[model samples]
Target: MDASDTIVNEIEKALKQLIVICNKYSLSGSLSTVNDLDNAFPSNLPRSTEVEFLYKNYNPEKLKIETGFTPIKIHSVSELSKAKMVMSAY
Candidate 1:
């Protein structure tokens, strides 16, 4: 893969690791899907619709951590959808 692809791959790997860690800790936060990641930070194509869906579904106030790379939070479906919409727009 090219440099860009490699970076994307690395980011995916890191996200997976974060998810695993969250699961292990029994964290009440949900991890973003690959589609969500694309929308939140599109590489080439336009952002995916999934980002808005997530924002609308999840809540942001319950967030315990947000490192740009990873966000951990306790969110409802509605809040997630809203977050997705807000993030996708930018």
Candidate 2:
């Protein structure tokens, strides 16, 4: 969800990572953190719809127990970014 701060932060971090990767390859690019919410969604769908969409969740406990596949645990943005960056390297 674009409205989610976590998602936004992850995107920002990913952009920064791309900059680093590009620079490593001698490429030039820029990243803008500004998120223009006005153009992010259809005008008919208000901001509240995004918030509700973000908050709506099916319980994850059952899936975890049944599948025995625990999701990656990230307590902070830094951890999430690091995990994603590491995963991306492969």
What are the models' TM-scores? Answer: 0.41, 0.30
Question: What digit string (tens of lDDT, one per residue) describes model 2 on residues 1-90?
Answer: 344666656655664565576456554322222244334334443345423332122111111111247543321211233545677799
Question: lDDT tens string, model 1, 1-90?
Answer: 676666656655765676677667766556543334434433443333443444333323343555578765555433555656777999
lDDT for 44 in candidate 1 is 40
lDDT of 1 at 88: 91
Compare the candidates by TM-score and give the number of the best one: 1
Model 1's lDDT to the true fold? 0.50
The TM-score between candidate 1 and the true structure equals 0.41
Worst 10 residues of 1 by lDDT: 54-63
Give per-candidate clash totals: 21, 0
Runs in model 1 with CA error above 4 Å?
A: 34-63, 66-90
